[model samples]
Target: MTVNYEKLRRRFYLRLDAVFSVEELNKLRFEYLSSKSGLVRGALAALIQQGVEAEQLSMWTGLLKECNLALARRLEFIRERESNEKLTAEAVDVSYPARPFKVGLKHPLVRVIEDTRKILTSLGLEHVDGPEVEDEYHVFDALNTPAHHPSRQMQDSFYLSEVGKLLRTHTSSVQIRAMEEREPPFYIFSLGKVYRNDWDATHTPMFHQVEVLCVDVDINMSHMRYCVGFFLENLFGCAKMRMRPSYFPFTEPSAEIDIRRQDGKWLEVMGCGMVHPNVLQNVGISPDKYRGFAFGAGLERLAVLRYDIHDLRSLYSNDLRWKVS
Candidate 1:
């Protein structure tokens, strides 16, 4: 039942010397020093349990305790060396040129919508939101679109049911809804995706539009003209605005807004006019007391003009190449 002290110490040193990592050192330490089945610990316990002479037990115990401290110090040294080697291996050079990384950019359409909102907001216009699938009353009746308006026709609209609920064709519906909720002596703007059964090089079934409505006692066509001019100047840095006689069911003197391109081409950008009495009355606002203006412009048209994109469909393709270009 006597412990072989010399043999146990030699075997422990052999195991410790083979450890080259902190994890390996930890395993080695546990094998020899753990209380239950540890080689050194078990040997010491066996010597005491088997009733060794006091002097012999004291000498052996003292020697083993010294060896245990030496083992621990050695393990600590190994741990430090392992850590230093890892640090050296993984060190980064601060002066070295960094690897290039790709960064995502905002979509051109999003940029257009954000810029449009920013410009109108700066002009004291409040931005508002409404539902995409809208009621017929808000989408048409509230906006003074007569029952026969081209936009409401089966060929143009995406009617959901016979009850007259469908995807809004323009942000104008949002403006109408906003007016109904509050009495206005204020300017409001709404921007979001609208839908219709239309598509071509210059059109899409789903597209974005920014709608503006200004309601006040003295709101006039001159105020709307200045607004159109101001918005174009700030948005596209466009100059040379031209307004012509146009018609909308909701406006008294509707004009299709056009901006003069550098190529001397007059590009129609938006529609604006004095709010009609009927549209005002439909929203419970008196026409004589609250005359104002409303304008709506396609965000895709702005993106096309701003980025000089040749095809309107490119904006909706979600193709990285088109966006990057």
Candidate 2:
């Protein structure tokens, strides 16, 4: 039985013309036009065995070629319409408002450190830094701390090796470094992390310190008082401060500083004193020709006081729930 290729072609065109999607149009085209087992392919296979009939062969060839071109045109039309619909659906509105995102607050400790640096720099202190791991000479001997000082005990300081090198307990080691490298008349301010072997509500094994040093002729307690007063007054907007006689290995006539809090409490802030003569001489500075004052305060303590923080551990808690006041 010979298949009517003309009827098959007409049926294909009718289905292809009616298809609204590229998928359906492709199926209709494949039914008659695909290379293997299609209506057109079956006609070609039959033609091969029966041999020649030039008129029928030419007619079938022309018809198959026309069908292929028409099906291609239909598939292209369906695909073009689909693409246009998608473009229209996804068009952006230039006038739409942008979404609002929540901004985060700076850590309280970071804010206090930045604020301190700004205030100190404005008060004639050039900021500097030093290595946290230090030798004993700079940290202890140059600062006038004796061999048997309680600070040298393993229970207090962290030792890296059997030798005297250890993690710096204060930023004063940085002060000694600057004095060793630069001749003064100079004011040096340093802010950095320091380590010790202590932990309590008011203390941590690791913490931050900010210290300032002034070395020049005739630097006295009056100059120290003026510098501290200017810094605190500007910092707390009229802070009331008091100094009490104290002691430190590095300083002569040492005093502990306390500032009146908003709740009428006197909070001890830091330790400061005139630079001891032996400390000056150890750094090759002639004590008879030059003198200086040094003061060191903890940044965590300042942050606590500045923001009325209840717990010192909160500074390093790393909780996203925490926010600066």
lDDT of 1 by residue, 1-325 (tens): 2346777767777777777766877777678778897776777687788887887677667756876787778778887887898999999999999999877778988888888988998998888999999889988888778887788898998989658789988888887888789987978999899998978999999998888899999888889888889999988886698998999888888889888999988999999899889988988899878899988899999899988999999887879875465
Score each candidate by Cα lDDT: 0.85, 0.86
Superposed by TM-score, candidate 2 places the C-alpha of residue 164 at a distance from the truth, in angstroms, of: 2.2
TM-score for each predicted model, relative to the true structure? 0.69, 0.70
How accurate locally is residue 282 in candidate 1, as Cα lDDT from 0 to 100?
88
Question: Across residues 172-210, which tens digit of lDDT does each residue of candidate 2 receive?
Answer: 989888888998799989999999898877888999999
- Which candidate number would show the highest TM-score if scored against the true structure? 2
Scored against the true structure, residue 131 in model 1 reaches a CA lDDT of 96
Task: Choose the strongest candidate by lDDT.
Answer: 2
Q: Tell me the spans in candidate 1 whose CA falls farther than 4 Å from its real position.
A: 1-97
**What lDDT is reached at residue 142 by model 1?**
85
